[model samples]
Structure formats: C-alpha cells, structure tokens
Target: MTIESESDHILFLSRDLLDDIELQRLEADKLLLKCSRLARLSGTDEIKQWIKLEMEGYNGSKELSDHYMSRTGRWTNFAERKGYWGPLAQIEENIRVQKLRIDVSKVESLSGDGLIGAMRMNRDAQQALANGISSMVAIRSRVLNMLHTFVAGVYYERQFAKVAESTFEQYKKDVDALIAAHAGEVLEKLPSVVARLQEGNDEAVSQALTTCRRIIDSFADAIFPPQAGTYNLGGNDLSLDANKHQNRINVYVAERTDSKSRRTRIRQNLSNLYDRVSTGVHTDVTAEEAFSLFLNVYLFLGEILHLGVAQTKDSVMA
Candidate 1:
C-alpha cells in the first residue's frame, strides 16, 4: 500500500476506536452516577440513624432493650409518659434494613436494567464494561498524541521516540565518530550537539539541529567555492549571487550518478530537514524529531564531503 493510503487507514482506525471508547466512557460514567443515587435512595432514614449511632460510638439503645424486655409499649412505667414501641414494627424495620443491605451491595454489580432493578445485571459484564472504558481511554490518549504529531507532518517526532535502545547507542557512536573525524575548526561547535540533541527538551534539540544546519551550510561553502569571485569585478560593485546556495546543492547533486541517482531523495530529505529546522528554531518542534532530522543532514553532508574529496583527488592526478 502507498504511504498516503496507509496513513489514512491508521487515522481512520484511530478515530473510530476513540469514538467507541468515548461512548463506553460516557456509559460507564452514567452508570456510576445512577449507582450512587440508588445507594442513597435505598437507605431509609432509620437505617441512616442506625448507622449514625454506630459511627458515634454508641453501643446500643439501652432504653429500647429495657422497654422490650418489660413488654411495655411505653418508654417508662409512668402512665402519663408515652414513647414509640412495637415488636412487629421493629421486626419489619429489621427486614427493611436487610433489604437495604442487599440493594447497596448490588451497586457495584449493577448494569443494564439492574441499575434500576428492572432486570438482573451481570456483575462480570459490568466490571468488563468499566474496565474496557478505562483501557480504551488510555489507548485513545496514546493514539491521539501520535496522530497530532503525524497530522502536523513532523514525521521524526512520531518515529524518534519509538527507536530501539540499541539504535540510539549506534547513533551515539556515529555522533562520536563524526566528532572525532572533524575536530578543530571544522566541528568546533559540535562537541555538545549530540548531547543537546538527546535531551528531553524539544527546544534544546531544535537548537542542536539549527547548529547542524549552519555547519552543513558552512561546509558546503567551503567545498563549492563561489563562482562570483572568479569573475572580474571591472570596478563595478561585485554583488554576491543570490542563488549561490541552490547552485552549491545543484553542483553536489550533479557529481553523483545521473538521473538514476538518489539525488532526488537527498534533495527531498534536505528540504524537509530545512523546513523542520526553521520550524524548530522559531516554533515548537519535538526534540527527538529534530535530532532525527539532524542525523539525516549529517549523513548527507558526509557523503557530499566524500564525493568532493574524490573529485579533488582525480583532478590532482590529471
């Protein structure tokens, strides 16, 4: 499949899955609220009073026990005094308390119609639904993060973080080699570039990429001497050529295998790198991606330098 098609496929898949997850999340949230309300409503005032008594460290009501044992419907022996008492009523209250216990216990297991006691609700289904919502939300978060980077066309940001640990070590070695081979003035500013590129901060990485771009431009200038100076000035103002940068890149591309060469690939990569470098310096660009782009530029510069050296040797021999 083409890259465009693949990207569209992934985008659609991510969006659809995220929509389903959001639906589940909403359902779970609604169920949770319903359960809470039911738990509250199911608790009778008497039950709350009983629970409050326990919460307040009251062992039990002594007067009720005394009145119950005496088989009196009054709070005391004084005929003029009256207080509520009924063995049947207390029995009925106990039954209601037991029913309340069952109703409250079902809160966690409640789902479908059982949420409202319309039908039996499977506890496992309820748990799975809740868990699925959580799992999907986490996945959705990750997918959206990647999609944001992808949609922005910042390919490196989505890719660099997923690079293997061993690959990073290899890249680190390449950086060290580049430093060692081009020490002194050629790479005087590059000692910390690799380190900064590896930082978690995007700003630092963008700075490093910018540094690499400058180094590449300077190296290109050194390799391809400007033709403007070669022409006689004739006492007229010697205006520097505006297309010198493009001319240098064209010269570099011309030295390689003709139409069959990967020169186009090089140019495209360089263009993307340049765009990203500009964005990195001026706006927010993920550091890892900036570093990845830096690696591409570094490799391209190395090839350009190698080719230039070869051509110089051939001319010397001639």
Candidate 2:
C-alpha cells in the first residue's frame, strides 16, 4: 500500500532503503516462518494466509489501498482508545503491563494449594456421608432395644426408678459396647463428613436425616418394633455435647455449623429423639442406624438455624 501519512512514508522509505535484494529474500523467509508460528499460536489457517499475503505485498488495486486504510483506521482507533498495540512502542508497553496484572491475578486465585484444598474437601464430604449413614443405622438399633427393655421392665413392675436404674445401667453398657465396635468407624469417616456438612443446606441435611429415620423406623418395625404401649418418640430434645464426652462429635458439628458448640446442642436433641423412639418399642434397631440418624438430625437442625439467622440479619440490616 502507498504510504499517505508523512510519518508512515518516512517509515516505509527507511525500511525500503534497508532492504537489499538478498535481505528482502531473507525477510520474506522470516515472514513465512512468522506465518507458521502465528498459525500454530492462533490455531487458524485464515490468519496464516493473511500474514502471507501482507508479507508478499499483494495489493490488488487502488481500491485495496482504500480498504487497507479503512481497516487500519479501525485498528488504530482500537489500539489508541482500547489499548492495543502496533507501531507505537509506548502504547504497547502500557497494554503489556495492564494485561500482565490481570493474568497474574487469575493465576493467584487458582494456585496449587487451592486446587488441592478443593479436591480434599470433596473427598472428605463423600466419606462423611457414607459413614454417617452407616452409624445412624447402628445407633437406631441400640436405642430401640434399650427403650423396649426399659418399658418392659417398668410395665411389669411398680417402681419405675428401680426398673429405669437397672435399664439405664444396661443401656450405658450397651452403648459403650456399640461405640467400641463402631465409634472408630464413625471417627475415621468424620473428616469427610465434616467437609460435606460444611457445604450442606438445611433442606439437604434434613432430607438426609429424614431418610435415615424412615429407614430405621422401617427396619425397627420389621424387628422388635411397635406394640400396644405408650411409646413417646416424637420429641426433638437430643443433647449432643452436654456431658462434654464427645469431642470429635463437637468438632464435626462445629465445623459444619460454623458456630461454637451448635453441633453439640443438636446432638443432644438427636440423642433425646433416639431415646424416645426406643423407649417402648420391641425392635432390634442397629447402632449404625442410630449414629446416622444422629448425624442427620444435627446437620438438618444446623442448616435451618443458619438460614434463620441469615434472614434475621438481613431483616435487621434493611
């Protein structure tokens, strides 16, 4: 294209004066090599052809010059206003630094540790769900049996305390045995469960607990289940860390709730619920089911409470 601007004309003359025939051939070869590199970088054949044509000085007519001027004007406006680059060295440097900052920020947000943290969180969540569910099943069974025996002993005697006292001792022993056998299993799965709980919503946690309750109730009915008795298992008063004995339980619940000892309080309510369910039933609910039920209850309650708190805060802010 014929250079119109004084500055462009000077640039063109200077370059032409420097271009010997052998140097022109070498420059053409360099352009061809650049075309290949651009094609690989851009992943397009059209850009390669455009580079080839531009390097070969394939101007068809005066109309082509007008067309080139129009395209150049568009690009020049964009480079000057929108910060692209061409022959202007200072403008190119400014664009380079601004682009560098944006690229660095993106990389910083997704470092290696960040990726690993996300992966570990996911793995932990899956493991927790599985273990919590299993524990629920076992706990359900143990609670049911304790309740059945307690009721049987009381129903056949006048002294409720005497009957309850012996039953309570046996209940504690049974619980200890059950914990001995299954506590490690639950603890092993806690890291993941804690992670999963951290991500759960109230509805999801409630649904999971509800599923465990339904499964346990169904299983209990199939075993030493309901009979003609006054079994009160509908109250939600389980105390989680009231006795301060369940440190692991506290940690899991706290992490999930993002609150201090909220999980413990939830566990207490869950325990009460279990006791009520098993109070008069003649069923063989397993310890695993009970633990799972407890976990579910804690998670569900925490989710609901969290949402309520958030809503309250928003309302206050408004």
Q: Which number leads on TM-score?
A: 1
Model 2 lDDT at residue 99 = 48
lDDT of 1 by residue, 198-236 (tens): 775866776787787676666555555466552222233
- The local distance difference test score of each candidate is 0.49, 0.40
Q: Residue 215's C-alpha lDDT in candidate 1?
A: 64
Query: Cα RMSD (Å) per model?
Result: 21.0, 33.6
What tens digits encode model 2's per-residue C-alpha lDDT throughout 197-239?
3446543344434444443333223222233423222243323
lDDT: worst 10-residue window of model 1: 51-60
What lDDT score goes with residue 141 in model 1? 43
